[model samples]
Target chain A: MNARAIDVRGLNKSFGDRHVVRDVSIAVDTGRITGFLGPNGSGKTTTLRLLCGLLTPDSGEGTVLGMDFRARGDAIKRQTGYMTQKFSLYEDMTLEENLAFVARVHGLDNRRERVEDTLHRLGLFDRRQQLAGALSGGWKQRLALAAATLHQPRLLLLDEPTAGVDPKARREFWDEIHTLAAEGLTVLVSTHYMDEAERCHDIGYILYGRLIARGTADAIIRDSGLVTFLGEGPGIDRAAHLLARADGVLSASAFGAAVHVSGLKREALEAALVPWRKEPFRWSEVPPSLEDVFIQLMGRERDERYTS
Target chain B: MTGSLPRILAVLLKEFTQLRRDRITYAMILVMPVMQLLIFGYAINMDPRHLPAAVLSHDTSTVADSVVAALERTGYVDVRYLPRSDEELDQLIRRGQVMLGITIPPDFTRRLLKGERPQILAEADASDPQAAAGALAAVSVLPTEALRHERLGLGAPRSTAPAFEVVVHRRYNPESRSPFHIVPGLLGIILSMTLVMMTAMAVTRERERGTMETLLSTPATPAEIMVGKLTPYVVVGLVQTVVVLGMARVLFSVPMARTPAGWLALACGIVLFIVGNLSLGYLISTLARSQLQAMQMSMFYMLPSIFLSGFAFPFLGLPPWARVLGEIIPVTHFLRIVRGALLKDQVLADMGNDLLALGLFVLAVAGAALGRSRTTLD
Candidate 1:
């Protein structure tokens, strides 16, 4: 049986008069890699921060790692590791020194061995003496991850962990994350990339400080009630702009030679594309992708935010 | 040809918007100069008056009373204490309670009547030579003024020489070297400037550079972080103190504490003072959002510390309100402790009040810093 690592409810956070996280309730199972997906300023980072004791909820009660997150923040912080979106290590210190500082902060025994093991595990041992600030973006992110997990935390919170990394580095970073999760270390990561989201065991979609969707990637897309039609033909991609304004067509965008048009009603979406159903244009019904569902959710919630 | 004018306007407009948003820098720019002008103009009295004095009179005669009255009438010396003995008078001077001490010898009246040119001794605390210079010069005209006093007309014919000579002794800096007074006090000012600014930028630097978020996420408490950051700077402050003290001794020939216990007291005072400033800097770091803001805040603090701490002027020369402000400043107490130990050879027991003040400052500022330090980003 998979134990619950994070079971939090009614999490609310506000900055000044702006409510950044509103009534966010989430639960993550142990050893699961849960991805938080949202647009900019949609409280994914804030919710992750609230769970890992980096920020206190305006009003929330939860148990993280089987302890009260609010009352046992110090204990939670010790057992939990947090990697911020920005590289937050000491730039002036060497990579080894950065990892060693983290090891010492958590008061780990045999600190030298831990630092050396983490450096080698991250493949940074060769460049251990390089200043963190002097390293490139990929190396810096790798060092930050090594430092975050140096204390062997059971729970990891990564905020946009692979934001600006190259594709190869991002793949390696994900592989390392999976290796850690296989060790029964629960991970909570926030990312904007749909490919990264698909790699997670489950996903949480946040919009306007509210968790509007939560489930596995397949389940979320299945429950979105969105219909999509992919069109293929000469100049059929140009029809996306016109179909996007048609009745009941929520989002329409071209993907190279093909165009994916999504909406709630299949008949209305098909009617919106009726103008391009000529010899040069051929359409087929397709399962709405995760990106299609998210675009629909973002549009629906943003409209609600303004109208309400 | 003038296309760049709008771009210049855009940059100027953006600059003003940012400046308006930074309330601390805005207030510093607007409020600092006015406050400094008012303080420097009204509180800094170079030729000060009503200096506290002590009179130890062995002569129980009308002439001694008239002589004390004459000195008081000069509007420079205020004879506030009548100590019973010379040792008590000397203690008052060393304690910094009195700026001047007068001694009326025995048979002062008889010596004046017999044309013996009796000597009335006047001793001034010359640590602040500026404060003592005017008051000491006032003693020179006392003999002529005493004879002119209608109440005690000594009915002596005017002669080439005055009847009695008022012998003046400038204690501590006998040569009235300004460097002796300035250098030791410079130690306090320099430590206040550097230690406070250095540690003041400590937490803010981390915050500005985005490292504070990771640091706070660890199991380290605010107290641990504060101590870990400031303890190193304490060593730095001590090394700075040794360098400045060595320079003061070797270069300026400034007298240091004679006894080893006195040196120990000075060292203790220095440590307490350094810790107090570092704690104050930590408190500023917790309050400031940016390193620039932290620097501005430290500069704001250092102005009052340098001006009102009696490093730039005599402590007694300031008005009562300014002295009250000076008393609250840690530098003021440290300056007194330093000047007293180095100049008067005072030991630990003699500097109890100032040391206690520094201890209280350290406690209060460190406590405030810990209180202000945020464990969470909120």
Candidate 2:
């Protein structure tokens, strides 16, 4: 079997004068979970939509699930499941009815039996009679998951599926995602949460409609060429705030009693931290964190924007 | 008393902001009454005149000529067609091409000279009796007044009833029952109002609920989804139709399916009407981004259909320009089909042109709806 579930190149989309997704090329291996990490309006959702058949690109070409994505969008849509940012299931319908509606829409065989099995598997059998709108945020997220995955799509795309969900529910949702990935479903989920990105096998960071970073978490942090210095002292909070505004500093924020300052250049970072180094404040060089790398990338992108 | 000025000003400002935000509602509030006034004032004529009348005269005598001439002078009848035979005149009236048809007997002048009253026939297209009422009532005095000078002194009776009497025959509705005109027309208006509004709201509600993205992402084609969305409403329309028709039959005493052919035509017309309106509403939904806009558009369509489609007034009462506008609306043609089939026992062959017009409307809307059901979110 082919390893790549989604392999697209040079995909672009624009609505009116606003160019949303530009030159987005991505390839997801089979059975792997790829997390798209970006801030809101960073082309994560639009790029995800382009990967699935929900949106046609202004100019793009590739195969999705081994079929020509544009020429065979209907065929692609049949095998793929896309969960939108909002809870989009029929609110007036019960859990079972929503699942049944999904089944009926896709023309799945043994619709009733499939719906029943899905309900039972999700532990939603008891409350299947409850309307989707009445469900709490966590339950609504879970129901959206069930509805998206009901057809056993080979590829899944979820755009910020767990935004407002609780921590416990998010863990369960990730666990479900991993289980589905293990079963050979290529899943690409978009979210801003650092933990969610860490949970994925690989991550892609998008900024200004372009994929800026793509790798495992450790690789992304290492490739960012970011350096950090962890300072521990009584007056470090005041020192950290001063350090953040100093030259060559990417970001510096208090993490507790201690403060961490990050920068792209080691010399500039050391020089910036030199002021508070002697007076009851001890500073040690540390490996840059994932959050530090993202901060560095955002600052660099802003610089690139002004320079261009 | 000091704070009241500020409070009232605050409310006025808030109202202006809301009114600006909801432009469609603003337009509806301001535009509806002005349009109603214009339609009622200028377009609507309670007593329709210059009605198209066909004259089928078998008499070649001067008396028949004067009678036909007199009917024209009343200003209610415009003698547009002179048919060769009585059957041709009946055909003209039956097709609703003319409001009335005058048929003079072959021995009309000879019988009147022999002091015998000859019955002159005037057939009225009574589907909309109000249009032909004045013309028929005035036909009784037409002959005596028309022959007043040419009476040959004592030869003719000119004081009261004419020697050659006009025997008015109301073809479709003999007693000119107003219910027959009104009850059948209600079907089209009710179906258009409900079916169009409901379907428009259904699609807009889906978008509002954010379910449209999920629906479009599925394998279900827009055509299939459209069918799924509109299928349930078909049943609703049918039930409503049944309720309205049943009540019309019981309460208003409107006749139901006078012929087997009428039953078939009515059933077919009703089905087409419901689907056509549903498709139109769906088209509106595709254009409307919000539920409020969809509702406003439906009201925009419904109000015009009620006023301008000749449901409230006579179809021929409006000017030629207005009739041209009415021809475009689906309700106008559907009303014709309903009244033509139910009251006049007109078969499909009789209203083929109307059925074709309505069928074309159905196809156009359905095609446009399907086309507007975009697979891509763009």
Candidate 3:
């Protein structure tokens, strides 16, 4: 297998007059988990679909799984698995039936054995006869995971797979994803949660169909060049609201009872905090967090929009 | 609970906005009833006209010619065919190109001039017994009715009893039972019901329940997905066919096919009709964006089929426009093919045109469906 399981270049898609995904390109190294983080409708889903050959790009072309993805879509589809943003297994069908159907659609041999193995591995065997609709949100996600992966796809694309799942179930799902990646399956997952982004081996942050930042979590935070000040005082929430409009302050928000103010100019941020530098309010410069960096990125985009 | 009225109203208003977003389905729901009312009200006629008939005249007498003319004057029957022999007449009625057949005996004029009773044979295809009843009754009185005319020089000289006799023959259903007609028609309706409704929901249900994205992501070709979706329905259609055919036979004692060829034709027709209907439903599934829309469209197709395919009314009685609409629907042709093969014991050659038409219906619908089923999410 090639080192890059997913290698695609310059992809574009539009629905009618509105362009949804434009001049986009992405590649995933084999056995790596790439987290996609963006606000909703940033074309994360659209790009994933384009990469998987589900939606045709208007102008770009590349290869997926070493095959010409656009021309040999069926071949690429045979080796790739996609889990949708919503739980998409048939609600009327039982869990066992859903897996078996996927297997049959993929034309896999020993379908019964494969279904049994999938159910047993996922610990969903007891609920094999239960309808997918009857399962809870977490269980439904797990079932969808099982159904998508039954064909032993070389690449897996998950769109917000843990959105409604509980923390415990979410951790377990992540653990399973990691386990599969370790077994040489390349995975690209989209999520909005900070903790989930931290768990990914690499991260890509998109804004308005444009990929603005991409690196490991640490690399992105360091490359952001953002300086944050921690303010814990009696009225930090009020201070945060005031600081948000101050010059050189990129973003200001109350994190729990503390106020987090981040900016590119550390001296200017300190100068702006002169009025609140008092006995009750203690301000200390700290390293920027992933969340703080993301906020700064969004603020930078807003700033550019205002200036333009 | 009473205090929640405003909140309930808020949700209701939001729901209305959502409903409006589904513009096609909402518009269709409003349009369906009015279209059905107009088509059924103005177009369906229980009393059919221009019932096609054929003539075989072995007698070259004026009496025989006048008798044939009298049958047409009844306004119920139109002589569309001049058969060379009994064989050709049988072929015409069996194929349902003509519903009524008149066979004048060679010795009818000779016997009538000698003051001896002679029979003028009139054959009516009784598969749809009611369709032929009005015309058959009129043909049975043709000899006396023709003789009563003073314009006929030779026939007027003889008394009413002196004229030749007319004998009526009811083919297909010897007793003219209603079930014989109804049972065969039910086959067409039942096939349309199960095949169209079931296949219509197949893909739309996937989309509504959010499974379409996952389904499309897989390596399965659109053709594979469609065939997999339709295979189970084909089996269901077969079981339905057997059940309906068995019940029709046991309950109504509908006549069985006289030859293996007729049975083969019936089998081919049922399979074609079922497959054709499934393809049509698949086309609808691709067109509709929601399961509700699919159901509405299915009903939109079915109502016209039931009304215009001669299920509840005589097909010949319908106006030309309604008949043209009926011709496009697969059920109408399947109805004729099934009834002809089972009731009239028509072979493939007899119902060839109908079978060919059904094939065309399948190809058109299936081709459109495949074209629409591109893997893109457009």
Model 3 TM-score? 0.94
Q: Give the alpha carbon lDDT tens digit for every residue of B251-271 in model 3.
A: 989877779998999988988
Estimate, for each residue in B1-378, the C-alpha lDDT of model 2 and write its tens digit: 987999999999999998799877887788978877877888788888788888887888666567667877888878889899877877777778888888888887678777687788888888887886966866766756666666666465545655566687887888888988888898889898888988998778888899989998988788888898898988999999999889988998877778888888888888888888999999999888788889888988887698778799887778887788889998998888888887777788888888888889989998998998888787
DockQ-superior candidate, 1 or 2: 1
Superposed model 1: Cα runs more than 4 Å off: A306-308, B1-3, B62-64, B113-115, B150-161
Candidate 3: misplaced stretches above 4 Å? A110-117, A125-129, B1-19, B62-65, B113-117, B147-152, B155-162
Sorted by lDDT, highest first, which candidate order results? 1, 3, 2
lDDT of 1 by residue, A268-292 (tens): 8778777788897888989999999
In terms of DockQ, which candidate is strongest?
1
Residue pairs whose backbone atoms clash in candidate 3: B48-B317
lDDT comparison, 1 vs 3, better candidate: 1
**lDDT winner:** 1
CAPRI-style quality class for the chain A–B interface of candidate 1:
high
> Interface RMSD computed for candidate 1 is what?
0.7
